[model samples]
Target: MTLADPAQITPLAKAPAQAAPGAKQRDVRLDFFRGIAMFIILFAHTPGNFFTSWIPARWGFSDATEIFVFCSGMASAIAFGRAYDTAGWRLGTARVSFRVWQVYWAHIGLFFAVATLLAAIDMTGAYDKVYIGTLNLWKFFVDPGPQLVGLLTLTYVPNYFDILPMYMVVLAMMPLIMALSRVHLGLVAVFIVGVWVFAQRRLLAEFGLADLHLGLPAEPWSDRKWFFNPFGWQLIFFSGFAFMRGWLPKPPVTPMLIGLALALVLINVPLSNIGVREFGFDWARDWRIANTIWITKSDFGLLRYVHFLALAYLCWVAAGDKGVRLLATGTGLLARIWQQALAIILKVGQQSLAVFIVSMFTARVSGFVMDNIGRDTWTVVGVNLAGMCVLVLTAYCAGWYKSQPWRKKVAQ
Candidate 1:
């Protein structure tokens, strides 16, 4: 079946009334998916957990990072886009700049926090070699001078700390992106795609432009490039932004398309499995080879892009007006439970920045626990459950803090 016309696409526009100027309406769908992504990310990041293997990454080319970044882009566009619409470009740009500052500091704070945690774990003799080697924390502490400089400059990032730096870069560019989007979304998309292609070919690396050293030593960390190259990842981010801005055509929900999407997901599951890796056909291997050009996670591969698109499409189809009504208004026990669960998730999602930061520390703590204690089934379950509870509590606290009358008074 054919898709609906782009011009006819509409937003849910179901956010509560704003008490202050420049406050954009909150979309529960964004919060719901973001919360889910946070949970998946926290689960997946905890090393040696059996549950990590069962995440969506095992079933598709994309993972929670894609969902997180895409949703973030949509959120940014909604927040800043509205600012620009009402308060003009100056305030919009200021808002973007302020957000960039916030994320930058958050990234710095997270790095130091994780480093301190690692240091504490090391002192306790619970330091896992895997974490140490992956994050290069040993090297970080050994030669703190240059590495610290690099970290401050966004030139050096350890594992688990890469996404925020990329996010900071993307936020820094939001003003330009918003400007181009206003002129024509097609122009913005083309520029983003061009940058992605350039990054994919390692053109920047070819020109010896991987990263800036800022007069620091190139030996340890100053010259190290970002793991999640912002250039390639920007395509996914901007695609989310564009879609949320109604720049892209929205397809009407149809049984045929939904069936096709489900079929694609089903087919991908086996193909993405370890079993398929063991018994790969020549055609499959060839397809894999072909897919490498544009599907690798390092460069935000094309297959990964397509997978997220399919997933987003599925979500769009499933979260229509009728579906939302059923979810919110149903009287059955399971329905009520789901509604309550979504409310909690929405709260977590609304405070995603704080929750995400807390999740990183929790993931590290959970990993440390698994490494020092045990990796048995029950142990894994207990550790994961504890980590999730902490995350939920963090979310609740953040939501409660934001809801306090003092906060409103302070804002006024």
Candidate 2:
């Protein structure tokens, strides 16, 4: 059921530097799972989508955030690691900086775009909910002077808008981590673990250890900090990066490992949100409350990390080596349908950054539509479906543009 020798796994680093024939093949497993996560993000972020309650978060300790961050780490390894390998350290860091710059502006642009939509919709005076107040962006709208600077400098990250800023900071940390990788991998491990521990200042504070938690200030005038802590989250991101960069060996799929992963996933269900609400697991609820920091989303809790890895390993096995299983569809009408669906999913995953931005934009629109039509069964279903269509369209559009179709000759 498994390869007994871990030595058979050739790391990306240990292997010869030359590119193998057809080495450009993208990992279908990564894109497919990321695409699934993208859909969950849309549902989770929608203001009043009751369907979101049924998502993985209700059934487990970890949710789509772990998937997104972890996949992003893998993606960065393929992208920036190549830059460092072929382009050398200086140019690679420059590439990282360029990406950071792009993401920075994207953060700024997304905030204003969402803000404008909220303002415009609110101005109509047609909706029951005050959109601005719903997100508590009135603070920014009422007095934009200092907060404008704070937003630009990433000092005033609102909770909903915090993910991009968190991503930007982690991307910025890549150069330092990459530099450490060159000196010695053990040094890199120590540095990563040390930063992760430092980020757990909130956990330390619970034990009365009086430490400063890791985060940027959420607002210039408030004690609140950024909802997502980059220092803590970078661990997952870099873990994926390390795996792809061959710093970590590929985990062999074994029957025992598979059984343990399934067990871990199932056990979490009893402690999950659905479990507490439906099964009336008061004890489980109490336990979670007692160990909030270990499961908290903000600090990238340990239980979540374990759960995600377990879940990830299972999915990895299911996807089959190199995700070849995902590509397989036997001869049937159902197979044909899966083939098309797979194409769409891969497209969405390939254009994640663009698709994610559009998904966020559409989530607000989805909420507005749901509010107007009311959240009946068919209406909710229709709204969700419509939002998904928009995301698919966004994906294809982004891909088309990225392909530089304009450069192709019209005719010979």
lDDT (0 to 1) per candidate = 0.71, 0.82
TM-score of 1: 0.84
TM-score of each: 0.84, 0.93
Clash pairs detected, candidate 1: 294-302
Pick out the ten consecutive residues of candidate 2 with the lowest summed lDDT. Answer: 1-10
**What RMSD, rounded to one decimal, does every model reach?**
6.4, 5.1
Candidate 2 residue pairs in clash (backbone atoms < 3 Å):
none
Estimate, for each residue in 1-412, the C-alpha lDDT of model 1 and write its tens digit: 0001111122434433321221244456777788888888899888888988778887777888998888877776667666666667789799778877878888899888888877765676644374555566767777888878877876677757888877777777788877886687678878888777776744445567655211212235345456687777888887777666666655678889888877766666655743255455456656666657556776687778877788777987777642374256778999889888888776677778888889988998998888778999999999998988888899888767756779788999
Candidate 1: misplaced stretches above 4 Å? Answer: 1-25, 125-131, 202-224, 274-290, 322-326, 407-412
Query: Distance (Å) between predicted and true CA of 375, model 2?
Result: 0.3
